[model samples]
Every structure is written in structure tokens, then in C-alpha cells.
Target: MNTRELTYVKAFNEGMHQIMAEDPDVFLIGEDVAGYGGVFHMFDGLLTTFGDKRVKDTPIAEQAIIGLGVGAAARGLRPVCDLMFMDFIGVAMDQIFNQAAKMKYMFGGAVSVPLTITTAGGAGMSAAAQHSQSLEAWLAHIPGLKVAMPASPYDAKGLIVGAIRDDNPVIVVLNKKMLGVKGPVPEELYSIPLGVANIVCEGDDVTIVAIGRMVIEATKAAQALGEQGISAEVIDPRTVQPLDIDTIVTSAKKTNRVLIVHEAVQFGGIGAEISSQVQESAFDYLDAPVTRLAAPFAPVPYAPILENAYVPDAARIVAAARQLVERS
Candidate 1:
């Protein structure tokens, strides 16, 4: 296997650069994304390389950023708008939901927006309430917007390429915690289709469905469970909106037990949707109830200790999955 290490941030940056060079329609617009290289430095040198036309920077207004992207997209341009934080999606939901999302359908599928809205979300690093949020569930409920949460460097590259090429409005959430993570990634340009689930690790005892940064935590927990004689499967639903129910349900049925994990609050997170879908799709095959591991319903605390507690970690996932295995 061709293997090496690369941070998640680099993979995204490289992939964005590659697509922009190859496709004239592909461009980026966001706050500090061009000249400033973005808050996380994901687009550090892109503006210099692609010039102002492709690497455009805009004001801090979320609505205007998204509104401009919608107009650009409707004109056959593939515009990727960085929302900075997924929490700010609330401010631009109208442009995302009412315009970019519903445009093609409203026009009888004759026009395609071909837009990708990429944002970062998570509860680590003490970004606190205004910044840290796992809001994929909010956008996934909309019919026209595609939601993708890539967990690894490989997925980060492939999914971004896929999102840029997609005809509908897509929301790609890059968890702040996972940006520095390194993993084996391909050098060639490729695409991970929307609505696909990646089974990072597989076992027969229990299936763990994780999103974004939680996938790494779930894998670590699965290893710990292995030491205790529990075989846990780790499945990352790369795209939540176009959820791969078939893949997840099949894995759950084979194992007969399932655990849903995410960085979002327990209430109304994507974990509930996965849990409900598992129960509905594989109800007869389950040996035990599906359990979920998620942040509690509260703002993320700034203190390191409280912040650690606020986000679901490897230990908690191990404990939760082990309890389910014991019951089974």
C-alpha cells in the first residue's frame, strides 16, 4: 500500500488547489480565505496561485458571502464559500435553504447551482459557544443541500473534490479538532461520491457510527474494546444528508448492536437520525438497543478540563460501547 502522513488541513488545501487549477468554473469566496489564507491557514497561498478571480475574499457578512455564492453558482460557476464556523450557518440559512438549495427544484431541474458550502465545526481547542458547534444535523434536514463530514485526510481530499463537482448545494463540515490529524492519502485527483459511508474499521461484535473528529475517537475506543474482547466496527458516514442507510443498516444487522457518536449536542444531533434509522431499517436483526455518545445540551466551556468533558472522548466511547456489549 502507498502510505504516508499528511495533516487534514494540507489535504484540503492541496485538493482545493488542484480542482481550481483544472476547472475554470471552480472558485472560492470567504472571510480571510484569500489574502489572509483563512483563519486556519487552509487557503494560505491559494490567492497568490489562483489570483483574485478564483480566490476571492469577501466581507464578514455571512448572508452576503452565501448570497454571492448562490448567484455565482446559478450562473454555472462552481463557487465554494467558507462559512468560517458552522454555527454562523443560522445567519445564512435563508440563502442556503431558500435559494441555493431550492433553486434547481424550483426551476424544474433545468438549472443547477453546483455550489459547495464548506464550514468547520467542533468543540475542542476552547473556541467556546460562538465557534464550536456540530451543526450538520441542521443542514442535513434540508432536501436540496448535501452535508458531508469527512473524518480523515483521504476523505478530506476526495470529498472536497466531489463536493466541488456536485450540481446541488453541498455543506462540507471540517471539524477544527481533526485539522491536524495525519493519515495516508492518494496523490491523484479523485472523488468520494456524496451519500457514501466509509467503514474505517470492521468487526462482528458492535458497530460504531461516528462523524467528523468523533471517527478518530471511535477508532481509538474500538481498539481499547478489542483488548477487552469486544470487536467494534467503526463506520464514518462521510455525508450525513445523503446518509448511506443501506451500508450502516447492513453493518448493524451483522453485528446486532450499534453505537452512534458525534461532537454535537445529544439532543437533535445526527446521531439520533442514525439511531432511528438503524432501528427502523434493521429492527429485527438487533440484539440490543442502539446507544449514542454526544456532547450534552450546553455551551462548550472554555476551561480545558470542562472542554474535555464537554466533548465525547475515546474513554467515554469505550465505556458506552462496552456497556452495550455487556447487555448483549
Candidate 2:
């Protein structure tokens, strides 16, 4: 495979572009997506490449966009709808939670919606609480929705391609902070199947399960911990819904310690689900408590300093892991 460095947005655009060209049924719809190329330039020039019909834009309505995508999906067309910000999904909960997510099951498997919703989630760029919330947990809790939060550019393309190709609805949230981060991405189109986890780093001391933007910080924490001779393994669950619990359990078993990290608030977060799963499956392997590194249970603060404190950083993960190690 020919590989090259690409920003997260570039990788995402390339994946969508490649999939659209290969699949005649695949199309995209979102606000300002056609002419403006999306709010974050993630859809830059896609309108020109795919034209108005396939790269259609809509008014500022989240529910309308989901409705269109759901209809298209039910009619055998693969539609990738962009909500811009995942926080807006709250406004369209009925469309997502009641309709799009449950269509196939409700229809007794009469049809499947190869529907993919791409949005920006998690705080880092000071987008404030409205634009920066990691709601992967909310989506994952849904019976029929597949939730994915990619960490790096390489996985961004592969996981998105996989999500769009799946025979079910998938929610892929792109963290804005990672938009400009560059990493190795293959030139050819491919997919990282849903429910798979990547062993980003291997160690025998601790297993660090990080999602979205927290993966970058967790990686840094692992590197710094290496200096202290603390071996830490990092695992990124490419798709949160289909969890890939086995990989996490194996990693925790190997390390004997588990530390979950995410940009989401601590209470009622995805980490709790992961922590529970690990404890249930790998309780005997843990030499210490299953720790967590997450933001407090509060809205994302707008001030830079407060936001910085509100988000999990490399230092936070490192310190948490260090504490757990000391306790063990």
C-alpha cells in the first residue's frame, strides 16, 4: 500500500470522494456542504467534484437533513448526511433515535439503510459547549446505531469508508482538534471494519483506552510514561457501538491495569460502559482499580484556560496512570 501523510480532514474528504466515485448509489447532503464545502472545510471542493445533485446542501435544519438521508437510504441510495455539529443531534433525536436508527429493525429486516451521518464532536478549539460535546455514548446506547470516533487521519478514512459501506446506520464524529493533525494514510481506498480495535502501543503495565481527540493525548501520555519505565498500551476503539470488547479485555489482561480516557464529561460517559465491560470480562486481570481520565460533569467552558482544564490532556492521562501504577 502506498502511504502518505494527510490531515484528518483531507483523509476524510478523500475517503468520501473515493467512495462516492466507486458507488453510484452513494450521495451526500448537509448545510453549506454544496457551495460552501461545510463549516470546517472538510467538504472543500466536493461540490465541484460530485456536482449539485450528489453534493446537495440544505437549509439550517438537522431533522430535515436526517429525514432526507433516511428516505434515500430506504430507497436503496447510500446517503451521508452531515449535521455539522453533533450537539445539534439533540434537536433531531426523533429522526435519529426513533426513525433512522430503528428503521430496519422496525421493518422486520425488509430493508437496510446504508446511512452514515458525519459530524464534528468533542471540545478542543474553544468552540464552546454547543459545538464541543462527545455524544458517542448517546448514539452507542441506541440499539441500531453504530457510533465511531476516529483518532488519526489514517483511521479517519478507513473507518468512515467502513461506516458508509455498512448495511446499517453509522454515526462518525470527527473531532475538530484533530482536523489539521497529519498521519500516514494509504493512497488506495480501504476500510477498517467496524467493531475492531487498533493496538497503537503495546506494554505490560497499563492499558489506556482512549477515544476521539483523547487518543492523541493518551498517546503522548504513554510516551511520557515510557520515560519513567512504565509500559502503557494504547487501544483506540475505531467504532464504539460494536465496541470490540475482546481487544480491550486482551489488552487489559496483558497489562494488568486499565485506564479509560475520553473528552466527554465523567458522569454517565462512555468510559463507564467500557469500564464495566472490562471489569466484567477481565476483572481477574486487573491489579488495581480501573481508572478514568475525563472532564468534569459540566458544560465545556469557553475560556481557554477553563477549557484546557475541562479537557483531558496528555499530562492528565499520564498522571492518572502514574497514580494507578503507584497504587498497584
Candidate 3:
């Protein structure tokens, strides 16, 4: 594979640009996406490369953005709609959950909404409650939508390509905190299959299943646990909706303990679903109850310190894993 180091944001930009060049039907429409290169610089050179026709900018309306994407996708065009922030998904819930998500089912599989909604998520850099939030659970809750939360630049590039190729509506959630994080990504276009979880690290003591930015924390926690002679396996559920429960359950069964971590609020979060599935599949194999390490049920704070406190770090994950593993 031809690979090069790229930041998380750069990898996605490369993937989208590569796809747009390869497929004439794929286009991007969102607020400030063209001339402004997107709010996060996700479309820095896409507009100039694809031109105004394919890289059209839209009004400051999330509802209109998603509606246009749904309509375009239904009519046979692959549209990548950037919502800017995951928190804004609430504004376009009808278009997402009701329209784009239900198009194929509503049409009795006669139509496919091959639409990809890419948005930044997670709390860090003190984006505050309005702009910072990991709402993957909300999208995953809907039956028709596919949710992919990429933790690294390599995965970001591959996942975006897969999302674009998908015939169903896919939500690509990028953790804002990891925007600058760099990793080696293939120079050529490639796709990482959705719903497949990556076992980042193998261990036998405890299993830590993390999503998005939390994947980094989970790995760090695993390293720390290793120093203490506690082998902790880290699994990154790259795609949350079509969750790879088998991989998670298998790891949980081997480790006999599991810790689900995410930047989103613990209550009603995706962790709850993962924890429940693990328990159901590996109930007899588990030595302890599944532990969940997630942000408390509260708005993301604006202050850096508060934001740090709100999101779980490696230390917290390590502590939770130790508690889970040590329980007699």
C-alpha cells in the first residue's frame, strides 16, 4: 500500500477529493464548504479541484443541507453533506431519520440514498455545549442510518471512501479533538468495511472497547495496564451502528471483563448498547459486570479544565479496567 503521514482532517480531505475525481456523480454541498474550505478545512482544495458545480456551497441551514443531500442521493447522485458539527444533527433530524434514512425502506428497496453526512464531533478545545458533542448514539438509534466513527487518519480516509460507496445513508462522525492527530494513510483510494471492529491490542485481563477519540485513550490505558502486568485488549468499533458485536463479545469472553468508553454522555449512549450486547453474548464467560467509562450526562463545558474533566482520559479508563479485572 502506498502510504504517507496525514492528519485526521487531511486524510478525509484526500479521500473525498479522490472519490470526487473518480466518480462524477459524487459531489459535496454544505455551509462554507466551497470558498471557505469548510469550517475545519476539510474541503480546503476540493472546491478549486472540483469546481463550483460539484463543490457547491449552501446556506447556513442544516435542515436544507440534509434535505438537498437526501433529494440528490434519491435521484441517483452521491452527495457528501458536511453538517460542520454533530450537535447540529438535531436541527435536521426529520431529514436524516425520517427522510434519508427511510428512503430505501419506504420505497421498498426500490431507491437508495447513497448519501454521506460527514461532521465533527466530541468535546475538546472547549467548543462548548453547542458545538461539541458525540451524538453518534442518536444516529445509530435510527434503523436505516449507518454510523462510522473514525479514530485515526488512516481509518478516516478508508471509512469516508466506504461511506461514499454505500447505497444507504451513512453518518461519518469525526472527533474534533483528533483533527490534528497524524497517522500513515494509503495514498491511493481504499475502503475499510463498515461494521468491522479493529482489535487495536490483544490482552487477556480486560477488554476495552472504545469509539472515536476514546480509542486513543483506551490504547494508552492498555499500555499503562501492561506496565502493571494487566494485559488489556483495546478494540475500536470503527462503525457503531452496524456494530461488530461478535468481536467485542469474543474479546470480552477471553478477558472475562469489559469496559465500554466514549466521549458521549454515559446515559443512553452507544456504550449502553455495546455493554448490553456483550453481557447477552458472554454472560457466562464474564467474570464481572460490564463497566462503562463515558462523559457524565451534562453539557460539554467551555473551559478547558472543565472539558478535560468532562471527557474520560486514560487514567480514568485504566482505573475502571483495574476495578473490573480485580473484582473477585
Candidate 4:
């Protein structure tokens, strides 16, 4: 288990480097991915290592970018397309939903769209409403797409590699704020299977299930709750579509209380689906109702003051956990 500390962006770069070196059929295409090395520099140094053939820069047309990937993937090439910002996914919805997502099913398993779509998401740098929305829920709703949201450098590298190797169309949603966050990741190539949940910490009184950037906030809340004599367990569902509900249900059965948190808006968010499944599977074991903490239904604000209040944080999570535990 050799490892080194790397930032989320660097770990992703290493994963891409390794995957491309190992598979000749794999290549990356997206705006500024080759020369500019991506807006966040996540794909930095890839063009120099793999050369222009494997690393290509495309015009700022998301629809054309995804359409090329979809077509390339259907023809037996593994194409990793970058969308820059998840907010721009709406512009290429047809290529994503109608083409890449349904190609395998439409061809009756004769064709497999081994396409990987990577994009940056989350609201922390005042990027405005259009650029900072957490839209994994929309991709997860599609039947043929697999959605992953990594919280750390380790998961970031492993999940990207896993998504590229997977035969189905997979979307890896990276957090803009977590790009510089550091964590221990294996120096060697590795892959983390989808549909698995990481238990961040072990506790008893309450179970806190978090997604993406909220996982970090949930960890902070668990520590604060610990000092106050409350035991809180934190679970990170690394992938939302193929969610690991069994882990959450098992935790609920132990703690008898559950709290789900995410950066997405509460209404029709993934938290609602997780809540429904947890209650349905572990109804009799619960001592209290399942609760969720998320952003409001309004668009993401631009003002620093409003954005700070908009996204959930450690203090908010701690307060929510305390209230859930105090319920009688």
C-alpha cells in the first residue's frame, strides 16, 4: 500500500496519466484540456506526456465535445470528455442522455458506450448560479448513466480510473473547492469500485450520510458532536446513482436515527431518494424520522455573504445532528 500525499487535482492527473499509458484505446478531448491543461489544471502535463494525438483541445462547444466522445466510445474507443463546468451539461443533454446513455441499451448490448464525462461542480468561489450548481442528481436520474462524486484525493484518482475502465457511461463530478485539498493516495495505479460507501468514522447515537464536499463538512460535524458527548457515524456515498444504501440502512439500524446531507438543493435531490430507501428498508429499527440538510430551492447566490449561508457547513451539520439526536 505505498502512498503519497497529493492534491485532488494532482491525483486526478496521475490517474489519467496511468490510464492513458496502459490503454492505447483511451484518449482525452475537451476545451483547454491539452494546451491550457484545463481551467482548474486538473489535466495539466497530460498533453506533454501523451502528446497531441491522445490529448486534444476542442472548441468551447460542449455538445460537439460530448458528441465526439459518444461516437468514439460506441466505436470501441474509451473517450474521457471534459465538460469544464457541470453547469454547461444542459447544452449537451441530447448527446449525453439520448446518445451515450442509451447506445448500449438501444443496440441490445451489442454496443457499449465506455464513455467518461468529467466536470467541476459546487459553489464556493462565487462563480455565480450558472457555474456552481451541484447537478449530479440530474445525471443519476437517467437509467443508463452512473454518477460518482468523490470527496478526497484518494477517491478522486480511484473513481476516475474506475469510471474510464467501466463499460457503461459514467459521470465523475469533481468539487471545485476540493481541488487543492490534499489526502494520501497510492503511488501506484488503483481503482475504487462504484456503488460503495466509505464509513468516514464510527459512532452510535446518530448516522450522518453525506455526499461530495458535504462529506468533509460531515466529518467536521462528527468531531464536534463527539466532544459534546454524542456519538455520530459519518458515511460518504462516493457514487450517488449506484448508491450503497445497504451501508446506510445498516447504520440506521444501529443508531436508530439518520441524517442525510448534500450540497444540492433539497427538493428532489439525491438525499430524498436515500431517505426514502433508508426508511423503507429499516423502518422498524428507527427511533426517529430520517432528516436531510441541503441548500434551498433558490439558485446559488453570488454574494459571499449569501453563498456562505447558502451552502451547508460544519456548524449547521452539528446543529442538525444534535437536533436529530435530541428528538423524542
Q: TM-score, each model? A: 0.97, 0.98, 0.98, 0.99
The CA-based lDDT of model 4 is what? Answer: 0.94
lDDT by residue (tens digit), candidate 1, 149-199: 989999998899999988889998988888899988877777899998999
Q: State how far residue 313 of model 1 sits from its true place (Å).
A: 0.7
lDDT of 4 at 208: 96
Candidate lDDT (C-alpha), each: 0.90, 0.91, 0.92, 0.94
Clashing residue pairs in candidate 2 are none
What residue pairs are clashing in model 3?
none
By lDDT rank, best first, the candidates go 4, 3, 2, 1
Predicted candidate 2, C-alpha RMSD: 0.8
lDDT of 3 by residue, 71-132 (tens): 99999999999999898899988999999998888889999899999999988887799999
After the best TM-score superposition of candidate 2, give how far the Cα of residue 123 lies from its true spot, in angstroms. Answer: 0.6
* Candidate 2 per-residue lDDT over residues 100-194, each given as its tens digit: 88998989999888899999998977889898889888898999999988899999999889999998999999998889999999999999899
1-328 per-residue lDDT for model 4 (tens digits): 8998999999999999999999999999999999999999999999999999999999889999999999999899999999999999999999999999998888888889999999999998999899999998899999899999999999999999999999989999999999999999999999999899999999999999999999999999999999999999999989997989999999999999999999999999999999999989999999889999999999999999999999999999999999989995
In model 4, state the lDDT of residue 262. 92
